[model samples]
Target: MRSPFDLSFRLKIPLWGSLLIVVTTLAISTSMMVQAYNDVRSDLVSSASSLGGTLAQTLFPAMLHDDVWQATEIIRASLHGGRESNVLRPELVFVLDREQKVFISSQPQTLPLLADIRQRGEEYRRLVDWIATDAGLETRSLELAKFHRIYVATPIVDTGAYLGTLVTVHSKEALLARFYSVAWRGLGIGLVVLAILLPINWFWGRRTAVPMVQLTNSIVDMAQGRASHLLPQNYTHRDELGRLFEAYELMVEFLQDRARLEQGMIRAERLAAIGRLSAGIAHEINNPLGGMLVALNNFRRRNGQDERALATVSMIERGLHQIHEIVNAMLVEAKGKARDFAPQDVEDIHQLLAAETRKCQVTLQIDSNIERPVPLRATLVRQILMNLTLNAIQASDRSGEVRCTIHIAGDQLLLHTENGGKTIPPEVVDHLFEPFVGNRESGHGLGLWIVYQIVTQQKGQISAESRGGVTQFTVNLPLGDPA
Candidate 1:
């Protein structure tokens, strides 16, 4: 709910991935089925050609000798028809002479002596047309595909002399039967492939999507200011998704750092506002206190003879003086010095932390390259550095490294301090800079409250993070106070 742009990757990946696989498989299966159909149909044509050529050779002697009985017997025997109507066989056979008169016929009654050959049927009319137009010696084939029948016309010749033609009719219903068988096999194969592959696809698709779902949930948690400890399960590849996991981790760390900084800025602003309000109240009270003290002195002088009145006047004067002192103290504290931050201030903090670092045996590396007096409060800057450096030194183990870097970038002065130590928990890091929130068991904190105060007063920002065995703090202070 924290992120509105969440995706249902778990459902989407498998649903779409399976769809893609099924579509691709079905396309491949369809292509294969079509090819099978062509093969079966081609086999029918080839059968016709081979059978007709043989019949032409067998009928050659019958025609040369004018033996019609032998040709008729050859035609009937070549049909290969079974007693059952469902048997696959040649549907018709005929031996016709060059004069377009049938010499022999399987269907003797319907196509008696070829009965002018062209008048047998509309399909045969087209068939004879093709055969008659061709050079008489060459073999030709006619396909009446819509009727599921084919005709192969082969010439019966004697020493290049034109003789009768042997025409064999083959049925493609047999091819359809074979194609249906192939299609069923293909369907079974496709179903088996889907049965095996779809589950794998579903499993792997969901597996791949798991990381994306976790990333989404992690984003939601981050948006709501919750720490996301989302480490992808066994995710170490350099693929696109792997890169995304790496990027997500980096993004989570970046957001955590930003959140800490913003929290620090907010707390500092609140404290700074409270300080300003207190100062304003002190100034307002001080203006009236002096007048009352003056009037008390004048009244005590005039009522000098009345002991009770004078006593009351003296007591009233003492109370006014006490009030005056308190107001003066508040006013003085409020008017902080506007000394510009200088390079020496960094050195002073380094010197102050040197003995502590030595005692802890921690290496303190300071990188302060500025030579000019920056337009920031020197005392406040020094205080922040001292507190951060001192705390880093204390947190670091023996022989551990503590680094502090200070530099100026454009309108702001940047400070970064870090220590190699145990990772501070998220709960502690949330309020690390808050007043009275103790990071260490022995103390309320590393003068972070004061650092927050300084940054807030300067209208700046501070953020801290403790993770990966490294505790770090960053502060950005405005170089010049706003008018």
Candidate 2:
């Protein structure tokens, strides 16, 4: 979470990287620049010395040998070649005798640099000491009027005998001015290159940081129950970041699946607890309810009643029978057995119940839209449909209508049913699908419980809704077509 401008070693990437590149580049550049300067200066001095030796060799000995015309011609030629050699060439050249008197000079239009070798005493004395005492040629700067020159001198010797000295002068201003221009130009180019690299460094740093940012955000979102989008796919890179992103995506998927499994586990635990409670309640009431049904049936059979008497007896018997039926339903749900799987036709089965619903003065609507060869366990599906429809009929007071609708969409088969019943309370909504927990005075809420188990074991979904004074339940099953 460090800001980009912090520029600390640990906080900023581009700053450190760019600083290192620049520092290293400048260090190398400075070393090379100094070396280059020394080299250029050395070459300049060497070239000047070579030109002076050539001029002196051609002129001095021959002049002493009384060849004045040849010496003069050689001096003119040396000066011309020196001028063409570099932009800043020698300004003056002169020879001095053993007494430091100018013996011969080039460009004599000016007064002798040492007017009287003895009268212009001190300056010449120091100059002589530097040239004679120094092991190599000597260079010193001089200013006369407005022009500046670098004075260079070398001992002139003939056959191991000391003759005098040879001197050459070069313009200081011009050499320095040109060097400054070139140096500045090189510095400007280096700075421009450094500037261009800045954006590139910024871009690379941000690209590297973005994935980490996204991963952090994803982790936060996943901590809540929200689904997160997958990270951007980047398979080309085989680095650790790519591996981390891949691992993170896998972990998220694993967590979501584990969460669903945990929810199912919790629901199962709730059902088990309810089943235990319902089984105890049903066991307590079942025998008495069964006895009541038996006595009512026995009395009716023995009496040989007329129609009015038989109808009253039949009503009482049927009412007692329903109590026994409810107790049995509770026991069945509490046992919680796993259902076997097979194929079944829902419409054909609905036809069997059509007669009973008609006799009860009730309407039955069955949808056969999913009659296409569906893979389902015949017994389980029949039990689930029958339990749910019967619950609907009973909730509707055995007189109100019960409607069943079935359809198949894509890879899922859906069955929805609604009956004329009161809207379920908010508090009861959560427990509606639980075993032994329904809304009948004699009811153990096992009907939906069994329905839930059958549909869920088939990898299907079931949900109930109560709205506008009517209750509806929808079951969804994945279309199992072979594999």
**TM-score of each candidate structure, all chains considered together:** 0.60, 0.59
Evaluate residue 114 in candidate 1 and report its C-alpha lDDT on the 0 to 100 scale. 44
TM-score of 1: 0.60
Query: Per-residue alpha-carbon lDDT of model 2 for 200-262, expressed as tens digits?
Result: 776666666666666767777877766576646633366987887888778988888898688
Off by over 4 Å in 2: 1-36, 58-88, 91-112, 115-132, 135-152, 169-173, 184-205, 219-227, 231-240, 284-328, 333-345, 348-379, 386-432, 435-447, 453-483
* Whole-model lDDT per candidate: 0.79, 0.67
Give lDDT for model 2: 0.67
| Tens digits of lDDT, candidate 1, 1-483 | 544235487978888888898999899999999999878767766777777778888888888889888988888787655555432357788877887788888988878874787777887778778877876676677888777776778888868887878887777776677788899999999999999999999999988888878877877887787868676464677899888888888987898889868865676666666557657887889778878888777776773368887888788888888777655543323246778888888888888888999999999999987788987778778878888888888899889999999989888899999999899999877767555565777654426766776676677878888889999999998878622
